[model samples]
Target chain A: MTTYSLPLSKRKRAVKTRPPRDALFIAAACALGLIVLVAVAAAVIPFAGDPARIVGPRLSPPSAAYPFGTDALGRSVLARLLEGTRTTLVLSTLAVVCTAVISVILGLVAGYAGGWAREVIMRLSDVLYSFPSIVLAILIAAVVGPGQAAVLSSIVLVTVPLMTRMVSAAAMSVAKRDFVTTAKISGVSAPVILFRHLLPNVSGTIAVQGTYALSVGILVEGGLSFLGYGVQPPRSSLGLLIQEGGSYMLQAPWLLFAPAAVLVVAILSINLIGDTMRDRLDPRETRSLV
Target chain B: MMSASHPDTDTAPVLELREVSVAFTSGAGAKRRTVRAMNAVTLEVAPGETLGLVGESGSGKTTTASVALGLKRPDSGEVLLLGEPFTRSRRANAGKLQAVLQHPHWSLNPRRKVGESVREPLTVARRDLSRSEQRQRVTEMLEQVGLNPAFAERYPHELSGGQRQRVSVARALVTEPRFIVFDEAVSALDVAVQMQILALIRELQAEHRFGALFISHDLGAVERVADRVAVLFRGDLVETASTEEFFRNPQHPYSQTLLEAL
Candidate 1:
C-alpha cells in the first residue's frame, strides 16, 4: 500500500489572506446599536425626561437648554425623539420577531414537506404579495383601528410574505441536498429534520432578510402612524411626531427634521447592515468582499 | 475475507429488491411525459456481501440505489430489509438501512460538527444508549474511518474532500446498519483517496458484516471492492455475475463495452 502525492500545482493550498475590513458595516452597526441603546435607556430609566411634558415656549427653535427645541405642543423635541425611538423600535422589533418566527416555520414546512403543503403556503403568500404592501398595511391597520396592535399586525402582515419567500427558497435548496435525505434515512423525526438540519442551513438567509424586514417594518409603522392608524396621540411614535411636525414645517423645520433625521439614520443603518450581512453570509459574495 | 462463492442460504438476505419499478412524471396536461426510471429491476444482497452496481450515466443506477435506500418509493414491487418489508413510511426500520452518497460535501450538514452528524443515527435509532455512550461510539467510528477523534469537533468545511468522505462513512456506519448503499461514494475523490476509501469500506464491511450495494461507473473501482457485479443499461438490469467471472468473460455486450472503455 503506497501513497501517491500530487504535484505542487495540483495540490490545494489554503489562501490565508485576511478579509478586508468594511468601514460602512462597522459604522452602520454602531449607529444601529446606539439607537437601540437610547431606546432601551429611555424605556428603563425613569428620569429620562417626559417626552409628553410641556417644556419651554411652543415652537421654539434649537436653544442651549433644548437641543432639538420645542414642538407645536411645547414638548422637548429631543425628548420626544428619544421616546419615539423607543416606541418605533419596540413595535418594529416585535413585528420583525413575529415575522421571523412565523415565516421560518411556514417556510421550512412548505419547502421540506413540498407537494400540497408547498402549494398552499406559497399560493397564500402569493395572494398577499399581489397587493401593494403599503395599501395592504393601511387596510389592515384601518380595519384593526389605530393603536400599537394595529401597527404591529400591519407590519407583520406586510413583511411576512417576503421573509417567508426568502426562507422558503433557501430551505427548498437545503432540503434537496443529500444531508437532509441522510437525516431522513437515519430516521430522525420530521420536526428534528426541520429544526436541526433545515433551519440552520437557511438561518443566514433569515438573518439577512430579517434586517430588511426590520427596516421595512419601521417604514410601515411610520406610514401607518403618519396616516393616523398607528400609535395614537399623547404617546409619540416617530411617524406620529413627523406627522405633527409636518404642519409646522415652515415655521420650525427642526420639529420635522429631528424625528425625520432619526428615522432616516435608523433605516439607513439597518439597510447597510442587511447589505453587509448578505455579502458575508453568501459564499459567492464573500470572495468579492475580501 | 468472504469468498465470492460463500453462500448464506441458511439466512435471509440483508436486502432484497423484488421487481422494483419507478416512473417519474414531469410537465402537465397534454404535454406531460412519464419517464420509466426503473423497470421492475430485481436484485438481492446476502448478508455481508458487496454487490457492485455498474452503469453509465442515466442508466438508473441512482434510481436503483434510491429505491434500495427507501428514498424513492418504487411504483410497484417491494423492498425487504432483514426479511421485513421496508417502505418510505416505515420509521421502525430507520437505522437498519443507510447510504453513502457521491458528494461528501452534500452528504453531511455543513453547520454540524462531525461528531454530532455521526452521533445522530445512534441518538435517533438506538435511544437505549446513553449520551456518553453515543459520544464514545462516534469517537470509535471516526477512528474506524481513519479519522482522528479530534476531527469530530470540526465542521465539514474544515476537512478535505477525502476527509469529508471519511466522515460521511463514519456517519453512515455509526448505527451498525443491517444494509448500506454506497452510491458512487468514491467517485468524487482523487485516485489515491479513492483506493484508500475503497480499502476502508472493505475493511469495515469485514468487521461489521453489513451488506452493501456499491454503485459506481468506475469498473476498476467496482472490481476492487465488489464481490459480485451487476450491470444496468437504460433502466434495465442487463447482467449479474461473480466479480471474477464477469471481468474474465462478460456475457452482455454492454458489460464487454464497459470493460473495453476501462
Candidate 2:
C-alpha cells in the first residue's frame, strides 16, 4: 500500500506542474483562433474566382469543385461565405473598439468626477438603457440609411450605453476603495489618478465586457442586414447571406446551412472565449481541475 | 496669535488644524439631515513630534486627519501644513504631506507590485529623482521599515499583514514628506506585530524627523508610542496633554474614562 501510494503522490505532483485541466477553455480558445484566422484570410485574400461573378452552375450541390455548392446566381457559396465572414468581423470589430473607447472615457469621467457631472452622465445612461438595444439600433440605422457606417454607428449607439454603465459602476466601486483615496491624499493629480490608478484596476472588467461586445455587435449587425438595412447591395454580410439563403432553403439547403453554421460558430466562440477570459483574470478563481 | 510672517515660521508646527469643521448632508428632501463629522477641532503636531489622536468610533478623529491630510475641505476654519494654508483645492503644498492609513490590505493597490507601491509617492511627488535613485531609495526605505529588500518584487497579497503595513510605511516615507498622518497605523496588527511596527516607526522617526498624527482608538498602544495624546469625544477635543500628564491626572471626564477603559 505504501509503494502504491508513493507512486500516486508522485503522479499528483506531476499533474500540478501541467497546465490547468479546463477543457471548455481549451475548446473555446481553439474555436476562436480558427474563426479569427478565417476572418483575417477572407479580409486580405482573394477567392479562387470572382466572388461577385457567376463562376459555376446555379444550385450545384456540395461537391469537390464547389465545397459549399452554388447559389441561385451561380456564385460560389464558399467564396460568398468567406466574403461575408470578412464583412461580419471587420464591421463588428470596428464598432466594438469604438464603443469600448467611448464607454471607458465616459465611465472614468462619470465615476471620478462625482456630483453634478456624475448625476447627468448616470441619468443619460439610464435613459439609453430604458430603450431596447436592438430596436434602438434599428431605429438609428434607418435614420442613418444603409451602409457599413450606418450599421457600425447604430451598433455603437446602442452598445455604448450598456458598456458605459458597466464600466462606470466598476469605476465608482473602485473609486470608493481606500487605494484610490490614498492616491488622492498623496496629491496625485486628478488625471493621473483616473488613468494610472482607476483605469488599470478596472481594465479586467473592461476587457471582458469588450469581448462580449464583439458578439453583440455581430448579432446586431446581422439583424440589421437581415432586415435589409445593413451592408446594402454589392457588399456581403453573414446576415445578408443567410437572408438570401432563406428564400432558397428548400431548393438549396447548403446555402442556408453553411452561412448559418459560420454565424453560430462565430457567436458561440466569442461568448465562450469571453467567459474563459473572465474566469482566468479573476483572482479568486483558483479551483484546480482534475 | 503669531503673524504669518514671523521669523520662526519655518519652525511652526508641521501640521495645525484650527477650529476645523466638516458636515455632510445625509438622506434626501424631507428626511435630509446635516451630520457634523467634526466641530471646532483644534490640534497641532510640532516638527519631529508624535501627537496621538484618540477617540471612540464616529467621534471624528478620522475627519480631523482628513482635513490635515488635505483629503477633505473643512466647512469652516483653517488648516496649515508646514505653516502653509492647506485645503483640498490648493496645489501649492500637495505632496509635502503623506499618510499610512488603517487597513494596509486596502491601502496598497493589489495589482501593483510592492516596489511600485513603495516608489509611488516618489513617482508622484519627487519626479526629479532619477530612476536608479528612486529604486535605491525604495530598497533603503524597505530596510529601514524592517522588510526584506526582495519583498518589493512580491504583490501585496503575497506578504503577511505585518509586512504589508511595513511596505505602507516605506511608501509613506519614500517621499520624505514634512508630515504624515498614521490613521490607526498599528491597530489592525497582532499585539506582538504591533510592538515591532511601533519600534520600527520610532526608529525611522528618529532618523527622518517627520511629524506624525497617530490616530487610534487603542489607548494602551497610543501610550507606548505617543509623546503627546489628545482625546476627542463626540467631535470635540476634550483634553490635550503630554502622555505622562494625561495618564497621571486626567482633566476631562472623557479622558479619565478613556484611561480607565484602557
Candidate 3:
C-alpha cells in the first residue's frame, strides 16, 4: 500500500480480518448457515420420499439408494433426517428470539430505574433463576401438552431470566455514565435516552449473549424432544431422531447416528460464531485487531 | 503570575455555596465506610469574575463543582446561583449554570457527531432554532473556541485532546449560560495546550462576562486568571481571600504551606 492509501488500507483490512483469522468463527458461521438453510428448505419444499414411509427393506445398511438406511419403523431415515432439520431450526430459533425480546426489555427497565424497582426486579430474576431450566421446561410442557409450541414456549420461559439479568447489568453500568446525565440535563426524554444513547452503547454486550442463547436453545430443544415432551409424533426433530435412534443401536446405528452427528455439528458451529461475535463486537477488541 | 492580573477587584458575588457538604457510603454490607468529599465548605464566585478553587489530589474540588452544577445534591447546605436557592427545587433554572468536565476523551460521547453535541442544550430548552440558525450558532461557537466549522461533523476520537476540550467549551458556551463550573477541564491536556485553553477561557469569560468557578491545583496558574482564590485542605475551606491578598499575606498555616509547596 502507498503512503496515501495506508490508512484506508488498514481500515479495509480491519473490516475483513485486521487481526489474524479465527478458524473457529469461520467454521461456526458456515455450519450455522448450512443448518439454517436446511431448516428453511424443509419448510418450503415437500419431500418426494415420505419421512414417515415404511417402504425400504428393514435393517438395510448404508448403500447408494439408502444413505442413512431404515429405522425400526421401516421409514427412510434420510427422508426423516431432512424433515427433522426443519423442526430443529424452527423450535430453537423461535425459543431464542422470544426469550431475548422479553429479557432485553426487563433488563433495560430494571437497570435504568434502580432503587426499589431494581431490587424488586432483580429479586424476581433471582427467584426464577433458582430452578434448573430443563426441569422447568418439562413442567411447563406437561401443563401445555406435548408439541412443538409447548416445547419452544417452555424453553423461552426458562431462558429469558438469564438474558434479562445480563441486559440489566450492562444497562445499569451505562446508565451511571456522565453522558447519560448530560443527556438528562439536556432534557431528552427517558425513552429517547434509553433507546438512542444507552442501547447503542450496550449492543456489543447483547450480541455476544444472544449467540450463546442460540447454542443452548438447540440443546434444550433436543433434551425436551428426547424425553417425549418435545416435537411429538409425525413431526420430526433432531431430538426425536435421537430418541428413535436409541432403540435399535446394535441393529442399525445410522438412523440415530446421522441426526446426532448433525446436532453436534450444529451446536459447535453456533458456539464458535457466538465467541467470534463477542470478540468482534467489543470495542476493546479493536486494539489487538489493529 | 500575580494576583493583580485581574483588574475587577470589586465585582459582586454571582454564585455561592453556604457550608455545602457532600457525603456518600462506599462498599456494601458491613465493609462500608462513610466517605465525605466536601465538608461544610463555604465559597463564592463573583459575577464576570473567576474564583479559583485550588486543592491537592482528593481535596474534593470536583465534588464542590458537581454540587454547584445541580448534578449531585449535597447532604446538607445550599447552592445559590444569582441569589436564588439552587437545589432540587430550582432544577429548571439550573440550565442558567453548566459545566466543563475533566478528561476530554470521556467528556464528550464519541458515538455522536459534534453538531448534535453542540446543539444539544439549546434543542433541549425547546429553542425553535431552524437548521440554518443552529448551523450558524455551532459554527460561531466552534470558531470562538479556535476550531474550524468543518470539525463539527467529526467524532470526538478523531480530534486531539486540545480539540476535544475546545468542543466541550463550545458545548458549554452554546447553552449561553451565565455561570460555568470548570471541573479540571484542562488538566488532561499538554502544558502548551493548557496555556492555550486557559488564555481562551480568559478571553471568552471577559467577552461573555460569565462567572466561572475555576478548579485547579496550580496556584501559579490560578494567580494569572482568578479574581479571588479559595484554598481547600482536607475537605475544609482553609482560606478564602481576594487573589492578591491570599498570595501576598496568607493568614492560615495550611494556606501558607500550600503556597510554599508550590
lDDT tens string, model 3, A24-56? 678778887887776577557745277877867
Which residue runs does candidate 1 get wrong by more than 4 Å?
Answer: A1-21, A45-48, A283-290, B1-10
CAPRI class of candidate 3: incorrect
Give the per-residue Cα lDDT of candidate 1 at B145: 92
Q: What is the lDDT of residue B20 in candidate 3?
A: 93
List candidate 3 segments past 4 Å from native.
Answer: A1-21, A47-60, A283-290, B1-14, B26-32, B86-91
Structural similarity to truth (TM-score) of each candidate: 0.93, 0.89, 0.86
The reply for model 2, stretches above 4 Å from the true place, is A1-21, A43-49, A282-290, B1-10, B87-90
Please give the C-alpha DockQ score of model 3: 0.20
In order of listing, the candidates' clash counts read 0, 0, 0
**Poorest 10 consecutive residues by lDDT, candidate 1 chain B:** B1-10
Query: Where is model 2 chain A poorest over a 10-residue stretch in terms of lDDT?
Result: A281-290
Could you report the DockQ of all the candidates, in the order they appear? 0.47, 0.28, 0.20
lDDT of 3 by residue, B168-230 (tens): 888887766678878777777898998899999999897777799988887877887788899
Best by TM-score: 1
How far is A197's C-alpha from truth in model 1 (Å)? Answer: 1.0
Extract clashing residue pairs from model 2: none
Candidate 1 lDDT by residue in tens digits, A175-280: 8778888888888899999999988888788899999999999999899899999999899999999999999989999989978988999999999999878766
Q: For each model, chain A TM-score? A: 0.90, 0.87, 0.87
State the lDDT of candidate 1 residue by residue for B1-262, as single tens digits.
2223334464579888889888889999998998887888889998888999999988888889878877778899888877877754647886788888887667778888889999999888889999999999999899989999999999887889899999989888888887899988999789999999999999998887889999999999999999999999988899999999999999999999999999
The better-scoring model by TM-score among 1 and 3 is 1
